[model samples]
Target: MTLLAAVAVGLAVAFVSLGAYVTVRQQMYRNLDDSLKDRAVQAANNGVLTNYYNLQRISSDALGLSDIRVGVYLDSGQKVNAKLSPLPPMNATELAVARGTAPDGYSIETVGTPNSPHFRVVAVPARFCPREDDQACDDGETLQAALVVAQSLKPIDRTLHNLGIVLWAIGLLGVIGAALAGNAIAQSGLRPLARLTAAAESIARTEDLRPIPVTGSDEITRLAVAFNAMLAALARSQDRQRRLVGDAGHELRTPLTSIRTNLDLLAQADKRGGLRAEDRQQLLDDVRAQMDELTTLIGDLTELARDTPQVRDAELIELSNVVEDALLKVRRRASGVEWDVQLSPFPVWGDERLLGRAVTNLLDNAAKYSVPDDTAGHRTDGEPLGRVTVRLLDGVLTVTDSGPGIAEADLPHVFERFYRSSEARSRPGSGLGLAIVKHAAEQHGGMIYARNAPNAGAQFTLWLPHAATQSR
Candidate 1:
């Protein structure tokens, strides 16, 4: 837009300058011609041509035509005695004027040694030798000679060219000024947008879904009002989601606890009866496994609900220690899994318990899906075993396993709640484990991703910025 405005202003300035230049040039030339004609009429009226020498002297001294040559011709078309000698041959129009037949006006022509342009004014009288007896022309009086006054216009032409240059310079300055003023106008007009952008960034940084201040009574102000209303709606919706997750988790916790307790009591009673011992033990193991899956799902829902900025800000924890602790917990829960813990010092800003839980969920997922059965000799004495590696490096936590890696098509949605691969549906764990990990990463200003490793396994990596350990 600024470019367009500058071009428009420049064109307008050039047009006005061209018009003024042409008008001034025309007017100046016309005034010069008129002045010359008036001088010729005065000379004819005052009888200056009667004394031709005096006419020459006055024309040179008083009219600033010192370089201009004057000529007079008698009615007989013969040159009169004058100041300049040997004048060029008169054209047919000039000869007619000398014979009292041409009109009284000016003519432009080229003359002089270098053949420069010249303007000439010719005056033809009715009678040059008027009889002294009458004030008017006598009956037998003949027409008088014609007087031609010619002047060079090269100097005036040079002045007009210079004046054109000045006008163009002034026009250029006007265009530059117009461009600057346009930029200022555009900036001032868009100030409201800049303010709104700043406010939006502030809200994003603070995670504060608050109303934006109104700037004016214009459309921009109405946009700000709409934005504030949207923020309010989003805040309410998020609050409702968090509350639902918390309530659902709370409602399921008691029932899951009772189910696990009752299953334990049944197992103890069957063991005391000693009837069909192996079958009872197997039933008890299945009930406990189901209860464990429900417990894990409930815990994941509770963690997801609590994964908020406020909860993350309540603690400063080291991720390396959390990874090690989670690895230890996974080894205890799934003793059949082989663990390789590679730790480093990685301080991050997050609740210790939440970070530990997130790491444990990742490991538990790897163990549940990837552990080999006893027939493969990968497990010893009915203990299913597979390799799990946990590492922390450069503010990043990575957990890898020698399990059937997730397919490439399923990688994108693995972190979504309740998403499970088709082959892993029979696994004894809720699919929310990775979802909780993702939420925990985000709440701590981090990100998490899952990918297949190059050598036939799956890897999960979590990244947190170093500034996460700093103060709010």
Candidate 2:
């Protein structure tokens, strides 16, 4: 903006100076031409063309001009008086004017020797007839002659040179003033941007995402408002990240501690020349269980921490098949739990493996919370619950268990990473299973929610848009 303003100012100054210079120069030349015309008129009225001696006597005194010359020419293109030649010889144009053929009456021409100064000249046709009371004569060929007048142009040139110097000085000053004004305007206009930059830099240095103050109704103000909104979002994301890291550390400690304890116990047993085979086998089983729990926790953390799950390869998947696959995998691990599954055509667009994992998580969660039923297939005072109902209709899949339902107070946070209610604290989990399920659902343009069943335990419902209608 500053540079553009400077160029505009310079152009304006140039145009104005050019116009003024032209007007002043033209007026000066007009005045000089008028003076030369007046002198030529006077010399013609004095009958300088009728007598050769009268033309020779014409000098600076005849007209109030310092550098002037006068001459007379006949129609035959012959000078009337050679002694009156203070200027250059008449050229073809002057000869034509004398013979009444050229159009120009006044001209600027170089006179005297080639090294001499230039002059302004004029030619007026006249009659050389004898002077009479009435100074009128017929336009006869023999009576035609041209009265020539010349004046030096040095004064006019000097005046115009001085004017040019003054104009250039004024133009230079105008450009300087415009540049200064443009700089001031640009600085004031960019002050808000400078403040915004400083605020961004401060955020970078301090790792703080506090919003900057915004004021005004311009584009810059809108940018500031958007920047503040971004900062607020970043602050929320950072808080979630910090909480996730803290919870992950806390969850890892339990299994890691148990593994270390089991290893230490085995080391002591080895030092005592080995234990009984059954005792050693039990210790090995406990160690293996702890290691498996650690592995599961780490894998859950990895799934929960994935930021760009949708970047994985996507395909049109039969969600019913995914659920059945999950049920088959869980059936191998669940010895006595009964799975009542009713699958139908449920197609969706997503990463098929991730969707399968989500379905598997839901089944595993249901199985983890239930106990195997007794021989009568009924719950006793000491027996835990066992039964799962998996159903799919249209694009919605629901998994329900006969175990205890989630507490109402913990329902809202069920899908939050590393969140577990007090009732679930004793369960062996890293609290990331439901979070991963929620992320997978959202990444596939779907949603998952949990609610207490009408008569029994909790039901988890996942709704995915159908592949035919899902947006890319």
Candidate 3:
């Protein structure tokens, strides 16, 4: 930034210096040319070269001509004055003036090389008068000679040189000042950026997720706002991790205690000269069930602990097939409840495994809650007379159970991690099933909703977006 500022300033300064120098030089040359023209008229009228023989003895001051070198060129382009100091060179313009071809004409040019003092030479038609009473000297019809007046340009050159030096110094100083100003702006105007960087580094070292203070509205402030959002997301993730750990520990403790107690009982039986086969078999069955429960709980915890969902392996799949597959899986475990299934072809783009898992959890949850319908009188066979209806149409999946609906107060938190209703406390569950289902639905850009049915049951509806065939 500083370099760019300096370069911009330097270019401006250079342009301004060039324009001013050109204007001043041109104006000075005009003034000099005017003065030289007046001097040329005087030299022509005075017939200065008639005294060329005594020019060495005559001072230019006596003729009121100061610092002027005078030369005379005849009509044949021959110089008559040989005693003039630094006689100006005669070019075509001087010859044209003396030959009467350009009676009122004048021309100007610079004479001499760079190593020597240059002369600003002007050639005008001279009214040559060799004597004060000569008829030809005052005659207007004749061209006798060209009065070529020369003046040294050393002073102008010196002034321009000094001006150039002054402009150079100014440009250099302007560039330096621009660089310093740019640096100062970086220090003060960009102070917020520096503060943000320092805060990020400090957060990295200390592991603190505190938000930075936001002030004013600017691009940097907008960046700070976004950074604060990122920090907030990170903090939420950390909190979720903490809650998951605590909930998982609490849930795992129950199964672990039961397994430990069973093992202790079996050991006591063995130390007492072995237990009966029936007791030993029952103990082994209880231990195996506890281990399975532990495995299931751990798997649920792992599923819920995922930080981000990626659909790189997603496929366009029919939602009906996934529902049918889930229904089959839950049929054996929930055989007591009647399933009323109605499905249709519903194409959706999503991770098949995740979608499949979510569908299964929804079915399992419905079948688990569909208990015996005592309101209609219990069956003599002890099988639940309640029904779990699963219907799919378009991109929506609806599962409703005709057992006990969720309470009005517990409806909102049904899908929260480790959240269980009063009636669900005694049930065999890890309380993470619904949470996993909701997470999958949301990750796939779908949504899930739960509500009480009109009669007496809970209804869960899952909606997914249509498939994007272009992605294929």
The most accurate candidate by TM-score is 3
Which of the two, 1 or 3, has more lDDT? Answer: 3
- RMSD of every prediction: 16.0, 6.9, 5.1
Per-candidate Cα lDDT values, in order, are 0.70, 0.78, 0.82
Tens digit of per-residue lDDT, candidate 1, span 1-472: 5666778899998999889898998898788777766776676666655344454344444545454555666667766533543343356566667675665433334344446454443444423543333244444654566666666667877899799889988988888888888888778867897899999999889989978878678887888899999899889878868765665666466557767776777768767884477766776676676676677667777777654655534566777778877777777767667777777787777678877888888888777655753332245776556777777889888888888899988999998766778877655555678888888788777889999878778999998877554565
Where does candidate 2 have its weakest 10-residue lDDT segment? 371-380
- Higher-TM-score candidate among 2 and 3? 3
lDDT of 1 at 24: 91
Task: Give each model a TM-score.
Answer: 0.46, 0.62, 0.76
> For residues 1-472, could you state the per-residue lDDT of candidate 2 as single tens digits?
6677778888998999899999997887788778777777776766644545444454545445446666666777676542434643467666776788876654444455557666777777665653333344455623677777777778777888898899889888877888888899889878999999999999999988989999998888999999999999889888877888899999899988998998998999899898899999999998998899899889888877776646356788898889888889988776457788898998877888889888999998888776532332344564434888899999899999877798999999999898898978776677889998999998988899999999778899999999889755
- Models sorted by TM-score, best on top: 3, 2, 1
Question: What residue runs in model 1 are displaced by over 4 Å at the alpha carbon?
Answer: 1-275, 310-313, 373-378, 381-384, 467-469
Q: Write the per-residue lDDT of candidate 3 for residues 1-472, one digit (tens) a residue.
A: 7888888999999999999999999999999999888877766666554333334445566766557676777786667553535566777778887876765587788887878778898888765544434333346543477878788899999999999999999999999999999888778878999999999999999999999999999999999999999999999999999999999999999999999999999999899998899999999999998999899889889988985754566778888998988889888777677888899998887788888888988888887788643333234477666789988988889999986899999999999999999888877788988998899888778889999989889999999888863243
With a 3 Å backbone cut-off (N, CA, C), the pairs that clash in candidate 3 are none
